[model samples]
Target chain A: AQSVTQLDSHVSVSEGTPVLLRCNYSSSYSPSLFWYVQHPNKGLQLLLKYTSAATLVKGINGFEAEFKKSETSFHLTKPSAHMSDAAEYFCVVIHTGTTSKLTFGTGTRLQVTL
Target chain B: GAGVSQSPSNKVTEKGKDVELRCDPISGHTALYWYRQSLGQGLEFLIYFQGNSAPDKSGLPSDRFSAERTGGSVSTLTIQRTQQEDSAVYLCASSVRTSRDNEQFFGPGTRLTVL
Candidate 1:
């Protein structure tokens, strides 16, 4: 079985400050990891993904994540926070098995302040 | 290109009633998926369909939940004897065929509330 754990349920960052959202995953086989952002009353949008091709993955809106196999973690980061970045973020994992269903984490609500 | 489409953006029904949620995938995408999102449960996978292959229902919570995809395009998820706990946002997504790296495009969800 595969599962994703988000370290924070909520994070507040002032505009122009750095943003960080932590996540850890567990999977029996090789896994594909992803970060998705959801604005209020909107559908989820993929930020980035890591499928073992690269350790560092860059995404839209100046966001990125690093996959660390040894630590079993994939944490999202941003150099400068923006008001538009306030939203809900989910950490997801898909096992290498044939079924190929995505398992989502509890999600972290980011609050960007001025 | 049009994103995934889901009908009846909101629904409210009484317990014991049956409800059906609809989904129309992207023009050429062959894979569709259904999920439930609630305040308590977050997001839970409900079903998946790839082309004409049989769907994966491993995530359906119980016997009262069922779904079907026809002609490899449109899909519907039906809930029988709806319970209050069934209240949640139902989400649908579609991808370009079956690829490990394929990203899914989601539809604005249907928020269902069972009284």
Candidate 2:
């Protein structure tokens, strides 16, 4: 079975500073990785995804993630943290073959402060 | 075009009651999924339905939880004898279910509260 692990349960960063949220995965077959953000009372929005074509993936809201196969990691990063970035982030993974199920991480609550 | 939509955005029911949550997937989408999000559990896969194929319900927590999708367009998730632990957000998503990729369009989700 495939699974995802979010190393941090919560992360706090000052406005204008860089932000990072770590994610790792374990899948029996090749996997599709994704980052989704959820704001209060809002539906989950896909930030980015890695389908093995590119190691570095750029997402919406100026967020990005790099897929490191050697380390089994897909850590999300941003050059600058904005207050609007405060929300819950989830790391998701799908099995290699098509028509697969998705496995979500525990979730990381991001808090951006001034 | 309208995105995925769910009914009863907010539901409040007493314990031991049964509740039905509805989802209307995007037009022409062949794949649909149901997931539950709790306070700490993030998102838990509940079921998957594609076309007229049998749904994959391996993620269902218990027999009390069941779901059905008709005409490959709409779905309803039913919870019998709801409990406090059943209080959470139910999310529905639709996709093309292609063999090469699956990009799901998600709904706002139905927030259920069992008091």
Candidate 3:
């Protein structure tokens, strides 16, 4: 049983301020992590994925996340927020062995203000 | 290229009725998946099909839920005797199974409402 917990249900930031959406994971083994964004009435788009590669992963739309093994965290960060960045973000985990099913977090709703 | 697509963007049905939802995967994707999104459950995997392998029904919530993929491209999920708790947005996704990246492209979900 692998899962992710999004620390915040909602996060607000100014247009030019840095944004942070926290996520923590619970897994018995090393698990692949991912971040996805869903705009209003739109399908989810992958932001970034962390396999066994780099600890610091960069994603589209100026977003990045650091995978901290000891802390069991994969927090999404952005240097600056834009109005277009307002969306629902989900943190997902997959243990890719016998099954490829993903376990998703409750999601964090981002709100960017001018 | 067109991404994964789902039909009947919105559906409203009465309880105890049956409903079907369809999904069309990317042209060359070998793996397809079904997921449900709801306020109560967040997001949950419902089923999975990969190439010619037997479909995975481990994620399905109950016996009333079933799915099938035809010719490895299109899939349909049928829920019999739907309940109000079954009302949720059903999402479809496809991916190239051979690729280690394992990124899945999603379709605009079909929102199902049971009254």
Query: In candidate 2 chain A, what residue range of length 10 has the lowest lDDT sum?
Result: A94-103
Model 1, span B29-53: residue lDDT tens: 8888899999888999988998878
Question: Against the unseen true structure, what C-alpha lDDT does each candidate score?
Answer: 0.92, 0.90, 0.94
| Residue pairs with backbone atoms closer than 3 Å in model 2 (clashes) | none
TM-score of each: 0.98, 0.95, 0.97
Clashes of 2: 0
Fnat, 2 decimals, each candidate:
0.56, 0.47, 0.63
Q: Write the per-residue lDDT of candidate 2 for residues A1-114, one digit (tens) a residue.
A: 789999999999999999999999997767789999999899988899898788999999899999998899999999999999999999999755445667889999999999
* RMSD to the hidden true structure, all candidates: 0.9, 1.4, 1.1
TM, chain A, every candidate: 0.97, 0.95, 0.98
Per-model DockQ against the true two-chain complex:
0.70, 0.57, 0.65
Report the number of the highest-DockQ candidate: 1
Query: Which 10-residue window of candidate 3 chain B scores lowest in summed lDDT?
Result: B95-104
Candidate 1, residue A72: Cα displacement in angstroms equals: 1.0
Candidate 3 lDDT score at position A98: 52
Which one is best on lDDT? 3
